[model samples]
Target: MNEVRHFWLGISCLIFKVSKTFRYVDTDNELEKQVGGYEHIVVRCPIKIVDENIVETVQKLPRGTIPGDFLDAIVVGMDMLIKKFGSSNKGKTHLCLITDAQYPIKEPYEGTKEDQVDIISQQMKAHGMKLDCIITIGKLSKAINQKILAENDHLLSQFSRKGVAKMRHVGTPTSLLGALRTRTISSVAIFKDEKVVQGSSEERLL
Candidate 1:
């Protein structure tokens, strides 16, 4: 788990360096305590990728807190984007999820896991919010429940079919870095005619 957390921080920083903008929300369920209490999901206001302070915050984020319900987190993140940008943002909005595919939806959600996944998929398509996921596999990968990981992959497949998501499974930190860089560049290139460029000139939450 420590290795996964370290690699996650590394990917976050790499994304920040290779993308025009970046924002992050840790999916640890402990965040609910700071938010008053759980309301199906708990998320902080998206941290704007403005300076080194954001990197520091990512590095300092606590690890091994109860993992938030994966599907609920997606729903809440989409809601946050809608509240901030409304329906007009279209393809400009993106939500990137990085996980080890080991956690399950431990908390109660509104519907069955299958139902929640379907709804989330439909919502992302309707709102034009691109969803990308980085599924990390490492020394601890064998401990992950195949059932849970399959469900997560199914959700990603739905988004992929809609042409709004990409999923990458990587085993090492170096490979994860390369995947993040490539995905960031490809995503940015969709909007710009020229070659992909990197700098914090726009706003994006991942």
Candidate 2:
């Protein structure tokens, strides 16, 4: 049974493992706490934001900011913010992005919910914490014919090394956003309700 009432005690955000490796290894995770219902996802974007005035003050430099150099500043800033949280009991921790902003040309692991659970669950156990979830905004496109694409045909077969990720075509205005609330790509967490269907951003609102 789902415990709806257990989720009412507000939320505290934890930021750890700012080592830019996406793996949380440090002993300290108390980063920041907010008095909300975990409505927003804390995304430590890989891109660093700089003040325009700071850049304008650098008169001696021949060139402006180097390409992708801002990412370092963001990483440092996020670490500092994480340090501020200071080991308090944050409700649920979700890893946004701990690496470069741009998607890797090749992904190290399948970015599925189940895959994420397995990979990060170990880290959570290491920290004596249970990570509720980590959400990253990215899209994937697929076209497959199960009958045509079969075994023993290397030239004609193309498959995700992680196997064909089960997908359900969710239609309507808030379909994509609503599906996220379920957290499981293969589960039915909501039902239709007139003009207002469930939203993928429901967690954000919760």
Best-matching candidate per TM-score: 1
Tell me the TM-score of model 1: 0.63
- What are the per-residue Cα lDDT tens digits for candidate 1 across 77-192? 56555655566566656666666656555434366665656677778788777766777776764556788767767765766776767777878756754553333322221110
> Each model's C-alpha lDDT?
0.47, 0.22
- Model 2 stretches astray by more than 4 angstroms: 1-84, 95-120, 128-173, 180-206
Tens-place lDDT per residue, model 2, 1-206, is 01000010001212212222222221122222332211112222121211222112222112211111111212222333334333332322222221112221222235743343344334333422321211112232243233321221221111112221112333331442343332321101111100011222223210
Q: lDDT score, residue 15, model 1?
A: 27
Q: Which parts of model 1 are misplaced by more than 4 Å?
A: 1-57, 106-111, 182-206
